[model samples]
Target: MERSFNINSPAEFESISLQIELKNINEFTREMNLNISWQALEPDFNASMKRFGKKVKIPGFRPGKIPRDRLLQQFQPNIEAQFMDDNIQKYYLNGLQEKELVPVNQAEISDVHFHFGEHFSFTAKFEVEPEIVLPKMKRKTLDVQRMKFISDQQDMDVAVDQLRKAHARIETVEDGAQEKDFILCDLQKLDDSGVPIIGKKFEKQLLKVGDGSFTDEQKEKLVGLKPGETARINLPDDREKTSSSPYELMVINVEREILPEVDTDFVKLVNPDLDSVEGFRDEVQNKIGENFDSRSQQSFERELTDAMITKVDPGAPPSMVDNYLSN
Candidate 1:
């Protein structure tokens, strides 16, 4: 809105014009120019002085009572500076409203000219949101490498063996002892002439086949032994701490590991979720297939994302890219 001037001066200046021009330098940038007439800005300046007067404090007067001339004389620079800021913002908003333009960031003001009697003018430059032109996309194909896991009979047998071992029943064997068997025997330290050393006998001592504590000779002697069988074997003497000496081992008991049959009760004991061995094998195969499918899907998604990025190289602003790298 242009204000009417009671005395705007020469006939040529009778009508004051507020000029605003917008120049588009590129698709993303625009320059805004504003030329404010003194007639239009004088009202705002007078209004600002009154507003300052209402809030300013003086030595000998109450609030809102200071003389206008005195207040202007005392704080002319501050008042002018504040009024310039407020007027610039007001005029900038007016320019935006008139042109119907939206800026992406705050406008940067340059070449400012402002005064009480002279015309106010400035140039504001800023970037606007760009119009993204998406490329004409055809059907793009991405290749995915997939590995299908199929459980074979050998894999199923291995799985069943593991389950059977986990639920195996361990019992004492009174006959031949295999590689991983256990034995309870009376171990007596003997003298050179085959007499048991007094108080040097370990009674009912438990040991396992292939136990590192025993020498190879001792393990070999105990493998084919039954209850009440006695073997005079040479082992490391605890008293001597370094040398091998013969000892009498009377086998008290022998133990063996027995795996359960793949029956309903045994399957239930091992896996409460599985009903039968065939069902468990099927479930295992299905799980393997599902895992392979999931991996394939993930690979396909990654390929698709990479392909899209390659197709569309969306560049970011220089300032944003610089800031990101700096941090």
Candidate 2:
């Protein structure tokens, strides 16, 4: 592969003409025939230098007092043929990046020309990503575990219990703490210097015993802790400690769970459109079935894509990858 770059700067424009050719190509390596031509860049460069020269200070010239000719000479390297070469490579690399292409061979440059006060032109020739030979994928029958959605009596009972809990009201208890009871506490952490850390204090921390959010060991330690009782839960040594450390929790009070009665009121709370418990139960069953079916379909599609990629096993060139990253 070979390319020629002709760069020129005119009175009104900066232009580049590129001519690229593929010298060799085969099944493993595809040669690219690229021609990159651009124009009207000189005036933009002149304008940019004019603006930059206003603030730039040069020897023997005060700020904004440098002549255009002097500035042009001083900053010519900054906006010369090499500048266009860099930009051309950028554009070429960007196009290849969009296609996720990897070139196997280095590009060859030839017939590079830069004529001052004339149009700019450049060309680059390089190897392109080889075409993948996709293997024919055969559709195969596979056994998949499928769940049939059916509204059963047990499912309805579980849903009804959840509804009752959602509508439940909290009640202050004068008695001792019990399992599944919520306790409001104040949590804090102090440094070795006895300075309290921010975000360590929780004035109204709610702790629920036997909840999956807490471990069995934590629940055991918290069990039977009464009002105004300060319980210090040790921080896990391996756990990540942030700004808050040396933790301690103070249980202020405990509240008993008062589950609401499962009636029309609970049913209405579960679904505003439902008037009765039976109607809410029916709606829940339908939604569950619909969600299950949607998830199953999505899983099947994902499996199909995985199988296709496995069969194809596409190969990529490392040089192309490096070129893509550099660009």
Candidate 3:
């Protein structure tokens, strides 16, 4: 690439013309032309000196005492020319870079001259991004599975349990062990050395004896147990250990929970919008349906995004990646 410059006034302004010749071996050659007319260097230098003279301090005088000619002689031409060169180079480079043009070689500067109070001109040369021929892609289709939401018996049971719990009240019971009761107790484990392990103690813990959560052995241990009653629970052989050692837990104190019966008042307490159990159940069903629909749409959108990206299969250049990383 070759560039030419015609600086009419070295002290005032410059006029530049740029011609770009791009040659790609065994490919194509492209040419581009640009013109720049920057303001004269002398005027800018004089203006800079005038501004500086107003603030510059001289040894023989106070601040703003320096003469314009003296200030120009000291700093004007070099400083003003440097500033103009920086701006002009930035402007030219930005235009080329925006057009994705890369110069394979240094741009040659020619016809360089500068005159006072005249326009500056310059020329630049560069290569551009190569034309890409995309390969034809065969369209292929595949069947995909679609998911739908359906309510099950377990879902109904969970809804009913939540409603029942919401309406239930805690009462002091003086009777025997019952189902769905929270038993508060403390637990201890024996280390391999047969000593009581003291970490992670349970204080006034609540355990619902039934509600289909306890194993048959656990249920048998809890049955007929009262407050302050302590029982030893055998740890399962396959139980996951907290540490890398085996430990055995000894249950202490079994306090049972007493769940209240489900009624219209309970339904009203749980659901402010519903006065009856049936209305609350209807609301739960609607909520479940709405949640399921939202999840289904999200899944569909994700699948569609994957499919679109697969179809496009865009290619990126190394230089483009480097530029992105630099930014």
For each candidate, the alpha-carbon lDDT, in order, equals 0.73, 0.61, 0.53
TM-score of each: 0.41, 0.59, 0.43
- Candidate 1 achieves a global lDDT of 0.73
Instruction: Kindly give the stretch of ten consecutive residues in candidate 2 with the minimal lDDT sum.
Output: 6-15
| Clashing residue pair totals per candidate (backbone < 3 A) | 0, 18, 32
lDDT digits (tens) for residues 175-279 of candidate 3? 646665556666555666657677844455566675443558766776666666666554443446333433332334444434455667766677667888778
Best by lDDT: 1
Candidate 1's displacement at residue 265, Å, is 24
Ranking by lDDT: 1, 2, 3
lDDT of 2 by residue, 1-327 (tens): 123443222233223333434444544454444444335445544555566677677889988779988877777655454445544454345434444555556554444444446544433345555566776545563334444445567766776677677778889875766789988888787666656788667688887876743457767777888888766564543545433335567788888879877678877777778898778767877776787688777777777666665666665566666768999
Clashing pairs for predicted structure model 1, backbone only: none
Off by over 4 Å in 1: 1-18, 58-60, 97-100, 141-315, 323-327
Indicate the residue-level lDDT of 62 in model 2.
84
| TM-score, cand. 1 | 0.41
Please name the candidate that would achieve the greatest TM-score relative to the true structure: 2
